[model samples]
Target: MARAPVRSSQAKVVSNILEKHGYQLGQYLGKGAYAIVWEAYFKKWRTNVAVKVLMKDKAEAEFLSKFLPREIQVWKGLKHPNLINFYQSIETTNRVYIMLELAPGGEVMDKIRMKGACDERTAGKWFEQLCQGMAYIHSKGVVHRDLKLENLLLDQHDNIKISDFGFCKFAATDVKNLKQVQLSETYCGSYAYVPPEVLQGIPYNPFLSDVWSMGVILFTLRTGKLPFDDSNLRRLLKQMIKGPIFTQKHASISLECKDLVRGTLASDVHRYSLHTIFDHPWMLPLVRERPPYLRDMDALYLRPHLRRSTQRLMTIRHTDGGTRSTANLVSSTRLVHPEALRSPSPPPSPPAHRPPLHARPPLQRSWGGREEGGRAESERERERGRGLAKDGRRRE
Candidate 1:
């Protein structure tokens, strides 16, 4: 049955649901193009939940009516410890609210910025959780078309919760039934992390594209740099066609990690499986979720460990005994300033490493042209106040 649209008297019921559940929006977690996340409390669990308020736009209004109902249906039956829990969804004319697991640590990008890239052991743990999430999503027949560091959010315990399914698709269609979708294009998703096939506008295997996206994520996590950079898209595409090799020996990373990178970058269409890269022993620690006491690991190890107010999982501390600050990351998201946060579509795929079967968009050097000093792409400055881009670009 078609779920009744959220309007008129129903909107008030939505708010009542929140009040009834005793969850009050505490602080705004962050925002996306059409969504804003807020930290709220669940009186029953006495815990925090990330309430994703996906607003209704002229373009998205109709989509949400169908999308939200569909998402709720799908989420209702799915249960897994690793998966982010979807508590409830309520809708008003102004917004569709999805109550989700709150991961306060922010995106992996936040970690990259704070720590300048993590070590192999740290990177592997993340890789394992990511795959576990992907594996779960795959098991449910859902294709998370968009997978990036930003999409993978970290909990208070620093465990990742794979969120954001705005671009997801259910595998209920065959070539004949899905013909309409099979021909779809627009290179949707964060550009820098997009798979090659999607860029070429071809029918893509969802799982493979997701893993390729994962590789880009791993690359960014360990190297503190993008893989397939060039002066221009033409050059980038040429190198991609030719297959670029990445050697991170200068970065003081381990050979096992390098092997992982190589394994991740190896994109033979014939050799695709979660176990393909999943079999690596180094990835074991990450795939297994840390015990409930993980947040306390730092406390146990640090000379003067400070227990966190939240779940007491493994405590994480740098060699200096100071915890990495994710405060900046949590607040710096474009959602903080919705009117100014419209972004172009993310550079969807073809990481700095090997090119997928497709050529990528031009590598944008954010560093101003000759007008600016000889700053590389990383040095580009963004004004704090800009409107959203019609393209699905990231707010960054």
Candidate 2:
């Protein structure tokens, strides 16, 4: 008889492997159609990591055999600091998990939820960073077709980490037969973020579709939601299929944000490229001046579990311990004393009782007889642990 293939996942074993690899699970961040993300820590670097656990099921054959490999390939080709880091992959007999750079800030959507809408300054800045990341990926010949608030992750210090490359394409190689590839049209991505050309039968420019998505992101960021109105998929698709014009509810939005959305959302086929939208005046300042805030906002909102990743940036790290960068490194910035950037303190430490069993002993034990010796030893161990934790901080 043939040997049986493994059944029932080794969840605990996989979890242990993650911990051993310096990844400690923090929380259940989110899950989508294929994978679940757990906030984790990479102890080696004292940073957070997003562990994407791909669910294994008989129905997930297509994702595992096809899309997963493509995602890995696209990620491996990418090397920008602003993009989310894809660390390593965990393979078991049945399931798969990928460890990634955790964004401490959370998601861009959270920012909108917190402040209603981002100001022009913030929106522009973020868009510029989006450009940088997109440009980098595009330069590498990859097009992130799905560019939206939900997919754009953030790390501590507010840096954007473009994520979910599930729908990404290796443009340089994918266009092996441009005619066949371009002509093929099978829709994917969030309904709210799809572009007009995608809705029509036309062979769309992936870059332009990305631009429209970016416009949508900006509109939502500045106004707390999308620029369109629809209650169903067919209706939304029909509305998005039209020309690039958006009628703003003036009572609900500012003229400035709506204007940018109007100009950026055009489907004239000529105006949808990032090269065109990025050239706008409102976006120019953001292109030149808004990285820090955008990055910081990313940290505060999108990747809160992935802390300290943005604590030091090439932009500011070169300065003389200042927030600004100096002549040492061009355009690189770093976070100076980011611990100071912490949120309103966490719930006060659980009532300090006997130092938990797991805590390293910190005090000196007494070498007395029997009963007295036992009591003293326990006290000494805790004293030593507290001292060590304090000393480690002081040394830093």
Candidate 3:
């Protein structure tokens, strides 16, 4: 059976529910199998926030029982610059609402899709941030099993914000030494990002798998393509076992960059640890320039659709004798964040070198009238004609 599209009626109902809690739902952001995300204005925060809503009835029992709880547990405690900020979570009788920091810059994948692959410097800058975020996550004994380009988002400043904790797990630790307890047996996450150990159905280190996923992301960012083709699952597993084959397609990437990729995607025994990746020669230079910010050139890769939405949000309403801009409305309501008003593209400047008002020609109306000085000129002409007629009459 075909699934129905998100109904406007349903959205209206949800919007009302959110309003009761001091939130006003804006446009639809995105959705997954179990949840829908919306851009919303939170009154208390006086900021625009992302709200993830999961319907209890629609979601799977397994998610409700296991993954959802784990995600919330992991997300609530995390505090890092690169990680998305978790505001709060609310549970009602039939739904669960999770509020999060909205990254205005949108997804990293959006940039790649809009423009081709990122240049080496740009890619390296983001990759370094990703590593830092992962390092922090691992330190907390959490593993992000679903790492991918799509999950990495950018904020207004264009710094990476790691998001989506649905598949995350707290790594089991031994009590005596407080070291890792055992390998994760669950084969979960996107097939394209999963490593060979995960594909072989063997117990695998979740942290290492995440690193492998990061490697895949880096490769795609540099080459504009996934390292391995996954059309044939059987062949893909074999190909992964054989290791990623570097080709002429990858010739543009530096030797050091290739070395990092090779290290991360290596066999389970030889896979590069997150610590090792941080210390690698390729990543060393990028480390100094930590917490990378977006450059003017990088702005070209930003999602156009998001830019349009931002412009729409800040649009001014013009009416006769009354002008009410969205910015004013936001201020009055104390709803939208100031960031929402910022457009990626600057407003067009007025044309340079305007003629002096007296020197400028009067605008002529198409229906045989002057827009400005033409009326005065016409009146003078009429008076002159009448005087000429009077003179003729006198002479007669």
The lDDT of model 2 is 0.52
lDDT of 1 by residue, 1-396 (tens): 122234445334444666766775465444444565556777778887777766677335445556556667776656665566778887767667788877666666656755666777778777788877776665555666667666777777888777666556665244222222222233455434554444343444555556667777787677765565422222333333333245544357766666676565543343235665555655654556433322221111111111221111111111122211111111111111222212432332442443221232222111100111232212223322132233233221
Q: In model 2, which regions exceed 4 Å deviation?
A: 1-11, 173-184, 241-260, 289-396
If both were scored by TM-score, which would come out higher, candidate 1 or candidate 3?
Answer: 3
Q: Can you list the residue pairs that collide in candidate 3?
A: none
lDDT of 2 at 255: 62
Consecutive 10-residue window with the lowest summed lDDT within model 1: 325-334
Off by over 4 Å in 1: 1-17, 57-59, 172-186, 230-232, 242-244, 248-251, 268-271, 281-389, 393-396
Model 2 Cα displacement at 168 (Å)?
A: 0.5
Question: If scored against the real structure, what TM-score would every candidate get?
Answer: 0.64, 0.63, 0.70
Model 1 backbone overlap count? 28
Give model 1's TM-score versus the native structure: 0.64
Candidate 3 positional error at 355, Å: 50
Candidate 2 lDDT by residue in tens digits, 1-396: 121232325445555767676666566655543455666767788876677776677325656777678889888778887798788887877668888877778777556544555666677667677877876665555677667676777777777878878767764433322222232243444445666445432344555556677777776765555655322323334445342333443355456556667766764333334444455556665664333322211111122221232232212323322111000000000101212113232222232234222232322211100112343344334324322221111110
lDDT of model 1 at position 52:
70
Off by over 4 Å in 3: 1-7, 174-178, 289-396
The per-model lDDT (C-alpha) reads 0.50, 0.52, 0.64
Error of 2 at 16 (Å): 1.9
